[model samples]
Structures are given as C-alpha cells and as structure tokens.
Target: MKRALPILAVLVVLLAAIAVANPFFLEPAGFLAFLKRAAPLVILAAGQYFVIVSGEFDLSVGSLVTAEVVIAARLIDGDESATWPVIALLIVIGLLVGLVNGVVTTKLRVPSFIVTLGMLLILSGAVFLWTGGAPRGALSEGFRVFGRGGLGPVPWSVLILLAVGAAAIWLMRADFGKTLMATGDNERAAALSGVRVDRAKIFAFMLSGLAAAVAAILLGGFAGVSAQVGQGLEFSAITAVVLGGVVLGGGRGSVLAAMAGAFTLEALFTLLNLYGISGALEFTVQGVIIIAAVAAGAIRLPWKFTPRKGDAHAAS
Candidate 1:
C-alpha cells in the first residue's frame, strides 16, 4: 500500500494539470500520445532504477543512446537489408558497455559515479569523433517502425515500458533481486553472505546498459538520428528514479514506483509547457528536483521525532 502512494499522487497531479491546462488532454488519444512520448524516458528511468537501487550510478546511458543511434544510422545507411544486423550489433554494444561498467566498478573498487562519468565522456567524445558534429545517414524505414509504429491504437514504446516494468518487478522479487537489494543495503554483509557482490554489481550495470540501448532504439525511431538526440538523458533518468522515492544510497523503493516517477516527471513537464514555462528551464527544474528529493528524504527521519520537554531530567 505504501508503494502505491507515489503513483497515485503522480496520477492525480497528471490528470488535474492536464485537464486544467487543456481539456483535450483528458481524451484517450491525447493521454496515449503523452504516454508514447514519455515512453523512452520512462524506460530509461526503469533502467536507472536498477543501477540506483543497487547503490550505483549509470551516467553513460545518455551518450550510449546517442552512440547507438548514430552508429545505427551510419551502419544501416538507409539499407533496409542492414536493419536487423545493425540492431543486433547495437544490443551487443550496449551489453558490452554494461559489462565493462560492472567489471570496472566491482573489480577495481572505483566508485560507479566516477566510472560512469568517465564512460559518459568517452561515449560523447566517440560520438563527436564518429559524426564530426553533424550526424550522418538516416534511420531505415524498418528501424523507424518501432518508434512511430503501433499495434492498433497502442504504441509499441508504451507496450515495451509496461513489459519492462513488469520484468523489473519480477526481477526485484527473484533471488538475484533480493541479493541485489541486500548488496545495496550493506555491501560488506552481502559479500560475507556469499552474494558474489562483484557479479551482482556487474549484472546491474549490464541491465542499465541494456535499458539504455532499448531506449536508444525507441528514441532513434521517434526523434530521428542526431548528434544531440540523447543529451542529458542520464540525469533525467536519475531524477525520475529519485522522484519515485528510491533512496539515493539504495535499499529502498520498488521498481514500479521508480517507473511511476518517470511518468510523473513527464506529466510535470507537460504541465510546465502548458503554463508557458521555457523548456530551457528544464535543467533548473531537474536541479531543484534532485536537491529537494534528497533533502526531503534526509529530513523525513527527523520529522517523526519531536523533542520531549525535560526528557533528560525524567530519565535521571
């Protein structure tokens, strides 16, 4: 029941603001479209949830998405015949990137934040070198299908989000999930219990990378290929996860809650746009969100304890 509150609040605010801003937003199509647009970020948030819940960070996902999209475009080069191969390559690249992240963080004992930060720079520089500023090639029609295509009235991206959400929930309930949670709660204790802490961390990084890849595919289709297609998405994903009530240091929150946080963010952005707010201010908004959420969590513990007058004297 506690897990449901964040989503309910998210829905309430979403519905109220959308309805108030534009009555058309209440219509099915309108809402569905919003879901479709928000799908990539939502999925990204889910991926970020895995990393965050595991007590780590994955800052490279944004640039990884960019790299994947750019690589897809250049390799496929509008060749419908090359679509399947390129996509497979993209997935492999994503997993490999994740593998590297996990291995380095666990084996070298470096902080994930630093490792992923380095990865972010590496990927961005790679993209810049590969594309030379302007992106080349075009997404094949087949490739674009996932982003723009749908099953009857439903968007594929939205369906993927639902499926991923379900999978994440199931994962959190599995042995791996339990151990992962334990690892986040206390790495030393988890390792002492024979949890294969390194392996677990590796797997978490891989999951995050896989999520970024999937998001890249959808985003590539929806937003089209560009050098800047995925800029700052990593931060957005982290913000969404934090907003979902996942504790920053880990050992708290549900996957469903994290994903709902992503939806809430999108809805908030939509509301912001409706009220004539500049999109340029999104970074500022995200900054506030991160600081405020962390601060709120920090204060929550103190909130429940009011000082008792003369308590020390009574004990004496």
Candidate 2:
C-alpha cells in the first residue's frame, strides 16, 4: 500500500486538473462514465502487473484483445444466444495463447520479450489475413451490455473492474502470489527453495491472457468491433503499471497501484483532450512513459540482477 501512494497522489492531482478543465467531471455520472472508459485498460494493467511481477513481459495482450474481439464478432454474428458461448471461447483462446507463450519462453529457453513479441506478430498477422484489412460481423446487444449498460447509477464495466481488482489483490496474498514475488526477486534462490519458477510464470502469463480476454469483451462492447480496437493497448497497460511504480524486471509493486495508474493515465488523456491535444499522440505518450518508468526502475535497483535460467544454461 505504501508504494502505491505516489501514483494515487498523481491520480488525485490529475483528477483535480480534469475537474478544473471540465466542471462536469465533478458530477457522479461524468465520473462513472470515465470509470467505464478506463475499465478495460485498468483490467489490462492488473494482468500485466502479474506477469511483470513474476519477472516476465506480455506484449501479446493488445493483439490478444484485438483477436478476441474480432473472433467474437465473427462467431456471435449478432446472435444473442451465441454471446455467452463466444465469451467462453474467447477466455479459452486467451488462456491457450498465454500457455503457448509461457511454454515457448520456458521450454524453448527463449526470452519472454521475444516470445510475446512473436505472439503479437502472429496474432496480428492472423487477424489481418482473416479479416483482409477490415473486420466484419456484429455484436449482440447482450454482448454489448457489459460495456455500455449499467445497474441503476453504476456501470457493469465498473462492477467488473471492481471484481477483477478484488480477485487480483486476493491472488497476490495467496501462496502462489508470495512465491511469484519471491521468484521475481531472485529466481535461482526461489528455485533452490523448492519453488516451481517455471510453473509460476506460466500461471502469470495465463492470468494476463485472461485479463486480455475480459478486456476484449468490454472493449468490443464499448468501442465496437474493429481491426484496430486494441491498438497500442499493450503499451498502455505497461505504461500504467510502470507509472504505478512497478519494476519492469518484476519483483515489486501492488495491483491496486497499477489500477490507480490506469486511472491517472486516463485522467491525463482527458486533460489533454480538454486542451485540444491530438489523440494521435497517445502512442507517443505511452512510449515516453514506458521508457521513463523502466529507466527509473533501473536507477532504483542500480546493482541488482539475477541471471535468468536461459542465461545460466548458456553460460554452462
């Protein structure tokens, strides 16, 4: 909780600026709407947090989200009855993708960065070939409800966000979570202490995949189905997690702070929009944030590093 304060404070300041720029932001409905918009990224950040904290990266999620939405639209094809089944299938697909990523990274002894980057390319190319540059198909109203509808004054997306946040926090408190932290802090030590480091990382990747699936559902509903629906989301999630003070090589940070970082990011974007900043600069902003955050992390841990398994294997 202590590590989260910096991001929380930044969020508050950003929110205050947003309120000043647009008085409507102070209203409950306005704020709820903002939360709804930010929900997907927040969820993605939580997922990324797990992978990063476990000392891995998941660059595939953005493409995973795009693939999910595209797959859902094609499968459901406006059939309300197909909605739930399609959602289930999306979750399964996400898990499978993550599993593949983990297996390739651990078993093949490939770097996680390389493995997930390959996944991102694979998914993107698949989507391009399947859609021929443009995605087709309609989402059912039932499917859209999760993104656009709400119960009374609150949104279903917001509710889902809360549920995801709670689950993330709980997982981090469990035995697996503690071991994951340990593995990130010192993989060799954790392995010698009887922790199954490989399995733990694979699980982290699966969680990231699950988060991408859920985020895809929400995004497809809210933003509609498009080939570019999830463009740059992976970077955005990474930026949010890093902004929250989570270390890039893993072994640090909290889930809640990562979520707050998402909110802060959204607020920063909102502020920029209010000032007439071009939306095209979003990727630019993300690039700056990610580099800065990782540099900061490196500076903080000036002399810390444990050789990865693949590195040690090669050395031997």
Candidate 2 lDDT by residue in tens digits, 1-316: 8778877887899899999999999999999999999999999999999999988899999999999999899889999999998999999999999899988987898999999999999999998799787788899999999999999999999999999999999999999899999988788999999999999999999999999999999999999998889998998898899888887787888888988988888887888888876788865775676577557655755354635446666788
Provide TM-scores for the models: 0.91, 0.91
After superposition, candidate 2 runs with Cα above 4 Å error: 281-316
The candidate 2 region of ten consecutive residues with least summed lDDT is 300-309
- Model 2: lDDT of residue 115: 96
Please report how far candidate 2 places residue 295 from its true position, in Å: 5.9
- Candidate with the greatest lDDT versus the true structure: 2
TM-score of 2: 0.91
lDDT of 1 at 299: 71
Clash counts per candidate, in order, are 0, 0
**Candidate 1 lDDT, tens digit per residue, 130-217?**
7887789988999998888988888888888789888888998899889888888778888998999888889989989999998999
Candidate 1: lDDT of 261? Answer: 83
How far residue 97's Cα lies from its native spot in candidate 2, in Å, is 0.9
